[model samples]
Each structure stands twice: as C-alpha cells, then as structure tokens.
Target: MNHLLIATLLVCLSTTIRAATATPPPVPDVEIVLRETQPLTFPRGSRLPLYLWTPNFPTADDAELERVLKALEARGIALFARWGGNDFAKASAFPLRVARLQKKLGLETSVDATGLAHGFYNGTPATGHVDKDGKRFFDKSFFWSPGCPFAVQPRYDAMRARLEPWLEKYQDEQLRLDFWAADWEFDGPNEWNSGWASARQCVTCRAQIPNLDTDFAAFQTAVRKVRAEMQREVFVKPIQRRFPNARIGNYAMNPHDGRRYWWDFFEKRTDGLPAKAEHGALYRPWAREFEDCGYTVAMPVIYTWFNLHGEYPFANHQYRWFYNLLLEASSTGRHTTPAVPRVTFVHWTTTNPPKELPKDFEALTETSYEELLWHLLLRGHDTFAMWCPAPELAQEVRPVHRVYAAALEYKEFLDHGQPVLFDVPKQPGFVVSALQLGKKLLIRRTDFGPAPAFFELKLANGTTLRVPKVDGKCLLLTTP
Candidate 1:
C-alpha cells in the first residue's frame, strides 16, 4: 500500500508541474516588447511642428480652412485639428475635407477626442461641484468634470476599447485624445460648488474601495491597489485587448503645478509620489506607470506663458526657470514630447510676452522663432504640437508662421543626421555659442548689450559661411 501511494503522489506532482508550465495562457497576445531595444530616443524620425485647434476658430470659414490646410500641406506641417464637439456642431463637418487634404499631402491625422467633455462613453459630465474646503466651482462652459465612479474605470477602458474599431473604421495611422485630457486640478477660479469633497467620500470611489473605517494611511494603501486595478481595467487592459498595436497616450493639461492637484492625486492614486518632488521627484510615478503599462504620456507645458511683462513678467521668469525642470520631471521614466505655441494662435503672442514686447507684438527683437524651436528640440522632446489660431491672426503676427515653417523643414534635415555645430547669442552684446552634432552645425545670436558682432561657421572640409537673414537669430548647417 505504501509503494502504491508513493507512485500516485509522484504522478499527481508531475501532472501539476505540466499544468504550471503549459505555456502560461498564451501571454495575452499583446506585443508589449518591441524589436527596437533601447529606449526610443526623441526625433526617432522627424515630424513637423503640429498645430492643435478647434475648427470653430473665429471667422474660420470653409474657404479659410481650405487655404490654411493648403498652407500646412505646402509647409509639410501636421495639423492636430480638434473636431467640433461643442454646441456649435454635433459631428465634425470637415472630416472628408481634411481627409482629402491629408491624402493629397501625405499628412497624418489624429482625431481630437473631446469625448470626456462630450460624455460620449462613460466619463462624468462636468457637474458643478464644491471642494472639501467648501469652495464651489465649475469648469468653463464647455469643459467637463473627469470625476467618475471608480467602477467606471472600465468605462475609460471601454472608451479606448472603442478606439480600435474607430481606427480600423477610419483607417487612421494614429489617434490623439486631443481635448479629453483628464485634468482634475481645481486651482484656477472655481469655489468648488459640488461639495463632493475627498475621494474617500466619493460614493462610487468608496464602493470601488472598501475599508472606509481604516486609517488614512491604510485607506491610501487600499486606494493604491484599487487605482492599479483601475488603470489596468480602464486604460491599459482594454487598450491591449482591442488595438494591441495602437500608440496610446494621455494628454496632460495643466502646465506646472501652480494650484494643480491632478498630478498630486494621480501620483497618490498610482504610487503615492509627492506633487512637490524636489527637482523632478514628482514625475516618477507617472513615468513608472506609463512604462510599466506600456504606453506613451504627453505633458504640455505653457511655454507661451514665459513672456508676461510687468509684475507678471517676473512670473514669466519663474516659469522660464522651471520650464526645463518641468520637462525633465514630465519625461522622467517616460518619453518626452515638446510642443510650442503655434504662431497662428493670436492670443499666444498677446497673452505671453517678454516684459519688453507690446500687447499686439508684431516682431520680437530679442529672440528669434528658430531659436525657440531649437530650444524646444534640445530639451529631449519627440513631437511639436502647437495651437493654431486663425489666418487673419497669423497674418497680423509678423509672419511668424513663415519662420515656423522654415524651422520645421530644417528639423526634418537635422533629425536623421548628426549635428556638427550649434550656437546662439542673445541680443545686446552678441553672446555666441556653437555646437556640433554629427555633420551638422548650429549657430545662435542673442541680445547681450549693444554691439553688432557676428561669428563665422567653418567646416572640417574648409568651408566657410556667414549667417542668413533669419527670423530667429539662429543658423543650421547640415551635411547630405
């Protein structure tokens, strides 16, 4: 009897082993790994600076739209056009028109998904709310609240789940949740009207996460577990199940903290990272989250906010000082994307200006547009997505679009080649700096003092040349 029992036990153990090693359920059929090994460096391939905007730009008639599209086609600029979703129109009226433009020009299109605001899938409508602190407020007339039942994370999951069919249905190369940025920061001007204070008090949030009588720390722990599940069930899982190969990313709206609590809550919900991380510590959670989840994250900074003059100009200075730091933080553990304010955006120049510039600034004597683009590029960003204002506004802005187009064309040249040299000198004293990438060179001129001084670019092949009459005091020399 003992021998028989031993033999039976061995057989059972073998069966268990075989079951454990039986291919692990086919690994979910998702290709999380890529053939390319190293982290994807920016400029993987060049993409022109993009302009993101609603088709409802003031005075944006059909003819104007066609003209602007033609201009973008000629300049090879990508247009991140927001399909009209507001009361002005129900569905995008320009899809066919834009499609023809893209096909004719070989351009790419990503829909401006405003579903979060439109309450398309399952996002919470922007119900006016009161904060825990007893402040009442509401997002602007068009914006919607992102607060939803934790159980509805599956709704978010389904939101993207619906994207796969849309992609195949539309034959799209990429999709951008353009305006559906899940921003929860309430620092602008609202008084917190809804009174739905604290995630702990959230009815759906509480149901999704039990243990309310637990300590704050313990509750936080529970929230973390649920948050992970939410992310998986909501964003990542459904995305993998549906598209499997779709390039997905969340668009961040708030620029850098400044009364913003979205990142803070997001960090806590994800991994308890502090919002005020000393010198970029706050970004690790999102970075780690995106990396682990296998997706891209886009954080858009208010680069246009750096030029506010007067007492506000000092604020702009503060913004400038923190710009690079913010980029570093946002890119931490994640890929970085830099987007500039489109020259076409009229308010961009008037709203954001160096204390020295006028309200309706026509030209900038201190900094050139190319210098701005180069600076954005140097900060380790992959794509350039900007907001495009109207054509009349573009014309009034001293033709900055012309400068933008030129820089974009040059960007294509620089992306594949190595930069051999670069230099930038601020105005006044002609502060000059030069840098070399591979076979290309960049030279910059700035206002330091008051001296008309210049630098010469000499190549290893004994070639010499002077700077051109460029909008921004910048120069680029590339090899074939």
Candidate 2:
C-alpha cells in the first residue's frame, strides 16, 4: 500500500476505535421536561453567568426547593448551597440533597461543606478555651480564646468521617471544603491575635511553645507553624486522600480589606489595625498546597460594602492588586496553572433587610453593578458568585435582576471570543476594557463621572474604531 493511503487508513482506524470507547455525556431530565430556550446575547463578548448562593435550609420542602431550582434555571443561573457552622455530618445532608435535587432538576450545583479553621466552642465543646481561673471564655464570634489549643485531631477526624460517606455517595459531584477561617489575621504585628493569646493558655500549646506570648516574634512564628499544621492536618491531607476527585477549595475573605489592613499596619496608622498578618504569605502557602493536591482555590473580591458606602471609588485598583499579588506568587516559569485562581466577586449583603443595612449602605445601583462587573472582567477575572439569601429578593429588587442579566450577557460574550491583548488608556477620567475575539473586537468604556461624547480605539491593524454614546452611556462596541 502507498504510504499516504496507509496513514489515512490508520487515522480512520484510530477514530473508529475512539468512537467505540467514548462514553456519552449524561442527559439531564430537566432538558426533557422543559424545552431549551434561546441562548442570551450581549452586544459585545457574551452573557455573563451567575452562581446563586442560597441559604442551606435543610428542612425546606422538596417541592419548594424544586420550584426555587426551576426559577434559577429559568434565569440561567447555577445554585451554590451555603452551609456553614460545625456539625458537618448533619449539615452535609442539606447540601447533598440540594445537589441531588439540582441534578434531578437538571440544574448545576456544588457540594459545599464548611471547615472551620479555628475550632468552634459551642459546636465542639472540647475546643473551648479555659481562662487562668478555669472558666471557659465564650464570645459572640464563637472563636475559641487565643491561647486555647485547636482540637485539630478531633476536628480533622470529624471532617473526614462526615465527608467520606458523602464523597462515596456523590462520586460525580465537586466538593468545595469552604474553609471558614473566621477572624484569622493576615497583617502586621497583631496578626496572630485571633487565637494566640488564648492558645498560649492551653497546656499542650504552651508545652509546644512556652514563649509564644512573651516573645512577639515567637508568637508570629508559632502562629505560622500552627497555620501550616491546620492547613495540612485539618484540610489538605485528609481531603486529598479521601475525596481524590473532588474539586476542593477554601473561602478567602475579600482581598481589599486585607490589603488596606496590611497597608495601614505597615504605615503605623491606628485606624485600620491589621486584620490578618502578611496577606500574601498567609495565602501563598495555602494556594500552593491546593495546587499540589489538585484542588481549586478561590479568593473573593468583596466590593459590595465599599460600593454601597462609597468609601472606595477606585475599588477595582485594589482588586487588581490583590489578584496580581496572588498570580505572581502562584506563577511558575511564566505560566499560571492548576493553581487555578478563581476570583469570586461577592456581594453578600444583598440579602440584608433594609433596616439591618449599614448606616453607610447605599442600595447598589444597576449602573454601579454593571460597572463593577465590567471592571473585574477587564482585570481578567471571569468566575463570580453572588449571595442572594432568598430567590424572591431578586424579583423584589429590580437592580438584582439587572446585575444578574449583565453577568449572563458577559458570560455569553466571553464564550464567543478569545481574549487578546488590551490596555488601559493612560488618559484620565476614562478607562477602556477591550477584548478581540475572532474578527471582531468588543470594547467597553467606563467613565468616572460624566459620560464622554465618544472614545477612539486604535486597533493593532491601524484601524480607529469610534465608540459613540449609546443610551447616554458608553456601551460595548464591536469592531473588525
């Protein structure tokens, strides 16, 4: 046989063999129950997708839950069942059922389990801290006293026991071990204050580090050591061994607060005393651990409060800084990989009642929400999660729907295009977010105050695309 003919025959044979072995993707029941609707469209790029963070109400009637799932499906959103606190075994069932229901409804869902970094006293009595007088210190925060020893072994065993059965049960689902490292500090000299003082009182902890309190440097060192131990013993090792295939991640606080706190600490300002210690150092090691164990890691960019209060106008800058810091640290040999840093733009207070809202809280305007979404996208973050406590609130609040619609639109635009080089113009008062996908380039211009008459985009091919005003705002432009 001729060489070319033989090669073609071999290719055909390989293709046939692959086809014979290939397994079909699961067909969801919802697809059959409800006819597929037309995909949403955006003027530029594609629709942005949203993940709904619903409270994990275990006792909610199945029918009501299904209705909620169906409503979310209609809106083109996925569900994120939020379950916090201890009692993992009991709480695990809620998310498991939610996941099952979502799968049954043909909607997407993640298995979210909370892993408290510092032990909770009420949930696990043994984890509480005793004062010098032998009285247990109890605080509203639920964090054990600083000098108390974290029941690392007990917590780890409990977590493993609780999660193993679920992992085996839902072998196909992704498990997010949302680390509620509540009140852990990431900056300054006071970084270890969360539990250090009380931790020192624990006999076991004191035996290990007798000088933890007396020596500030020793306390910091001990805190780092304990953090690493907790990351390994409490989370990474057990999860990797038991649920090897699960998509695991920890909950990270909004990076802006961390940055500002650290900035203030380093500047010796008393106002924003460091909340956590050495933000980068605290997260970098954990990021590496997640990457090494083949798990997903997320850092949330919480711009809602700032946007609401209007304290920070240029919040995106801080977000960009935080992301870049992590990116740089997580980068290896000029490429960033499975350290797949997911930046979740979180707006948790949307569910707060009007009376409960902060004094500085201003209802997030649709324009502001859209602008923030675009700003984060421009900074190279696509994954987003919004905490909407109740589904009905989306209807009650017009801007919530508007914000979600923009996200869906952005996701659609992204799906249709490949990201290319884009730069922020040096000129003041305006910023341009541009991406060239295929033959067309989608550009969105955002102005600080008044809308500019028009902005000119100088493309690589020496083409000038003039983006004029659309509905009194600088909307997206598609240029070849």
What are the clash counts of all predictions, listed in order?
Answer: 56, 32
lDDT of 1 by residue, 1-480 (tens): 699999999999999999998876422101111111112123223453434332232224566656655544444344443433343223444553555455555555544444422332123433223345544333332233434323334344334444344334343434322222222222111112221234444544446445643443344444344433444454545545545643344444212323231222112222332234433223222212323333333444433333222222222332332333234323321232223211112123433334576563343222443344454444333344443344323322223334444444446443543333323221123333334466665554444334444445566778765644343455665634
lDDT of all the models against the reference? 0.38, 0.44
Worst 10 residues of 1 by lDDT: 28-37
For candidate 2, the lDDT comes to: 0.44
Alpha-carbon runs more than 4 Å astray in model 1: 1-46, 52-71, 81-93, 116-149, 157-165, 172-197, 200-250, 253-299, 306-347, 350-370, 388-392, 395-400, 408-413, 417-436, 439-472, 475-480
For residue 471, model 1's alpha carbon misses the true position, in angstroms, by 10
Q: What is candidate 2's lDDT per residue for 65-150, written digit by digit as tens?
A: 78757655555555455444556667567777777776676554554444343332224445555556665543222223322344
What lDDT is reached at residue 287 by model 1? 19
